[model samples]
Target: MTENRRFLLRRRPDGDPVRDDFELVSAPVPSPPPGGFVMRNHYCSIDPAMRGWMDDEPSYMPPIALDDPVRATTVGVVHASDNDDYAVGQWVMGLNAIEEYSVVTPGHFTAPVDVEAVDSPTRFLTAMGAVSLTAYFGMTDVAKPKAGETLCVTGAAGAVGSVVGQIGKIHGCRVIGIAGGAEKCRRLTEDYSFDVAIDYRGKDIEELRAEIAQAAPDGLDMVFENVGSPIMEAEVFNLATHARIVLCGLISEYNAEERVGLRNLWQLIVHQATIHGFLIADYAPRFPEGGAKIMEWVREGKLRIDEDVQEGIENSYDTFMRLFSGANEGKQILKLP
Candidate 1:
């Protein structure tokens, strides 16, 4: 129990992240330094964004250096602490590794969790967490969608995409969700209240585009694109004049062996459309407002959220792969014993 278990990046992944890309290793758990704490993690977040961080190239966040423990946000109970602010057994969330134990500095990567305000602890890592924040800001600030407009969301059955679609409905836009399979497409329309849904799996680019075009016969006023691939081309081909595309994620092409250029660039010019990419961290100062609104919607029964949780740190590697293969149902997370 006193030893620390960690998954270190063995090398920079080329295409898909394979199990061998990480090496499980152990070390004696270290005591917290001055103004720091040692935590026994209960859960670790597995995000698609983590894949982008695995590469050696520069990004909005730093890449994981070789041999360093893979970085992930975790919720844990304090096992020990040198900081006066955090007592032993205090619940906290912080940027920790996918390890059983972690030594975290107080401010830079750690924060105390507010358990009383939420329905459950894991909710902090779900609807009330980073995924929802990303959805909120991306839809509100950048897309800036209005009532009666047609909004199409890619990856709509997953965490962030589901949230975006619901928020679009709340704003009075007609929401269409594009998912990989028939079941997810049904969930979007039935469970998430998306007006329509399209299944992109087993369909070629042309076929998928036809489905997207059919779903949005009035043309797309805004696109909350989560799975960026040929789906982007399909969505682009259907853009209305002056449409806004919120580039939240590119899950489809994250691990592609070859980078394929989106051939619909000319459509942007033809439609006078605009696409913008954003980082959720850029809206850190507005977390209180955004978090409050999302929570309010949850309490009012206006938002629907789900999580795909796998037990144990041992399942971490396989659980992470589920995101790429579209095997996970919702927000993917790992629970540690």
Candidate 2:
């Protein structure tokens, strides 16, 4: 029997998750049934959403059950198959576990990948996976930015944030990005085509507000929010009339023991702004439309994709921690041989 190493949830975390929250175990690989296939995982994505899944609270998706294999998205190659549609040696992406192998039914997943067209096999989890889709739908469908509008995106150097800012520019909006450091801020403006980028690491609230005013003199028409809490409180002060705020991931509060409250909520009512919190899964039905458009833009050199990959499944927890510290510049993934 083939042995598979998998990470199991040891306990739900109170603050930032540590390696102790997960336990690695070795188990026998399950044999594929009549219509199932076995996959050897190549890459697995580590997202901030996983933090929300740890809590047993109401969310777009169900919480990860205690003692269950840590839930994640993975790309793997079919090693054995009983399903006619999924032949051996084909590469596929699915909602799998942080494991060495998986036994999946064809119906519960997506079609196999065409590796030749993508820049890397891991791109399936980055540009072509849920990250890109979240940026596409959240910006285009939810925010609905128009020409000459001022667009502001928080977590501006992250996987989804970088794409969000670029798409804003493509639609003729003046894009401003808020990140954690000068290096990230520089990359957003110089490399990602954002009109202005602000570093929020050392800046006081007043300085941040002034920076926003300078970058977006007309105020912000669309705000793609990825970080919540203190930063979001500042964003509320800069919103223009009728502005649309697309609430994506809230990485800032993921590690907090107590929920951080926003102080400037009155700005929302006074500015007539709309704050819409969304999960990409809600728009899964329209994923193909968003994916095709993003892919087309990538092919035409209109969009840029960035990835920070850490080798081996054992490092998954540490790589995930990078998101909170701004150590990763883009979509963070773990490679499993």
Candidate 3:
């Protein structure tokens, strides 16, 4: 008998999610109904945002239900289809959960993908994927950084922040990145080619503030925030006059019960700065325009991509923890059988 295995959400996590929080069970492979297609998942995304979806509370999207497959972006090739709009061999990406196969429709989260534009289809989940798209719209639309302006990115070695710093460079800004460790901080300057990098490994707030001030000596014109604890707290103090803080995420507080409070609201008022939180889904209407520009840069060698591809469906839990512990380099993805 053909069987499909899925990771079901067994419990809500405390500080960090463990393999015990989920259960993998076997089920019959689903057949696509009319106007639907079945996808054989190739690579599934392990994003920081997926951590937010497991809680039993309301937010941007509904929480994953108990005993249900966890939510995630799955890229795959369609193997069976009952719909004319989709072909059997077509490649697609969507919120297909952490499963080997998922039923999708045009109105669902699935979208057809073109893998020929970059080095590999995996780029569809990295450079040309939601990661880069989030960076593009966040910078161009929210931050609106200009040439000679200084932009600092937190979690700068991460999937979104890496793209954020690079895109800032492409737009003619002085880019600075803050990563957790020395190696990642080095990769930020050497690999992604950011102008400056600050290592927050064992540093305190004063140390981080001094580093930010030194790298961006003139103060920060924009902040592409990803981490939201001490990293964010220190950066907020260095904001230049009329600075724009695009709060893309708060990974530092995602797993905790009591969120780490930002104690520097006075800085925003003192500098007359603006802080706005944004979601990539909010800019869905402009995806084609955003995706096209990112791909153009990739093909022209103006933008770079780094991905940490881990194999196996059984390793999803450990693979996900890497993101929180700063163990994974670049975008984290898992290949399924």
Candidate 4:
């Protein structure tokens, strides 16, 4: 454990990334520069966004440079520090990477996490982390869901999606969740208390549209879009008048070799709908407020957050692939050994 083990990007991926696209290299643990600290990353977040970061494209965040450890949100303890703001042994979470150690300077993305404030230290990466915050701000501030309105959330069984659905219910909206499998759909209705759950697995665009239309007979009032392409295309066709669409993540197209344009763009014009692309980073200043409100909901048993934690940094590739393969159970996390 003396040498820091890093899962580094060696080459850009053509499509769905393969193991050869990355290299697990052992290097000397990075030292903190002036006004910085080094953290021994204990948990690494595995998200669909990681795929987009691998591509050399203009995005909200810069693409992961070649030969560098893949960027990720990590929760770890301060192993060494050169800053008075962050002392050694303090637990912190922020934008780091999939490496044994990370050199961090306190900023908008970096913050000390009160480990005792939550049930587990990893909660900072799950329920109280960016996942829930994304759901909170996206649902409340962006989508602006209203009572009696029909709210449809794609990838509803996911970490953010699940929370979004519950928030919709709390706001008195009729929640319709579209997930991948029978189990996930069942959980959407039973575990998350969604009004209706549509299983999108094994369904074509037409079939999925039929199911969605059936679920929301009057059309959808608000759409929290996570998966893109076919799912988005279907959701667009079923928009209610003056609908608000929160464009969160396009997970489906993240690893696609060729992107397909949505055929139902005109539906938005016809419905006079508004689609707002949302990024959690935009609300960085209010993370504390959002986190507090979300934790309150969790304590009240109004929200249920799940995390799928995999062991060993060596399993990073397989763990990350779960986001694409639909193998992950919940918020995907990688626990360092």
Clash count per candidate: 0, 0, 0, 0
Candidate number with greatest TM-score: 4
In model 4, which runs have C-alpha deviations exceeding 4 angstroms?
Answer: none
The local distance difference test score of model 2 is: 0.87
lDDT by residue (tens digit), candidate 3, 28-75: 989998889988889988999999999877898999988889888888
**Pick by lDDT: which candidate is best?**
4
Q: Candidate 3 has what TM-score?
A: 0.96
List lDDT for all candidates, in order: 0.88, 0.87, 0.88, 0.92
Tens digit of lDDT per residue, candidate 4, span 1-337? 5799999999999998999999999999888989999999999989889999999999888999999999999999999999998998999898999999998888879989898889898889888889999999999999888899999999999988999999999999999999998999889998999999988888899998998899898999999999987988888889999999999988888887788867789999999999998999989899889999989998999888889999999999999999988888889999996
lDDT score, residue 181, model 4? Answer: 88
For model 4 the local lDDT of residue 246 reads 96
Q: For candidate 2, write residues 1-337 as lDDT tens digits.
A: 3788888888998898888988888899877778889988999988888888888889777889988877889998998889988899998998888889888877544568888887789888987889999999898889997999999899999999999999999999999999988899899988899998889988778888888888887788999999986788777888899999998878888889888777889999999999898788777677668878998999999899889988877776788788888899779998997
TM-score of each: 0.96, 0.96, 0.96, 0.98
Compute the lDDT for candidate 3: 0.88
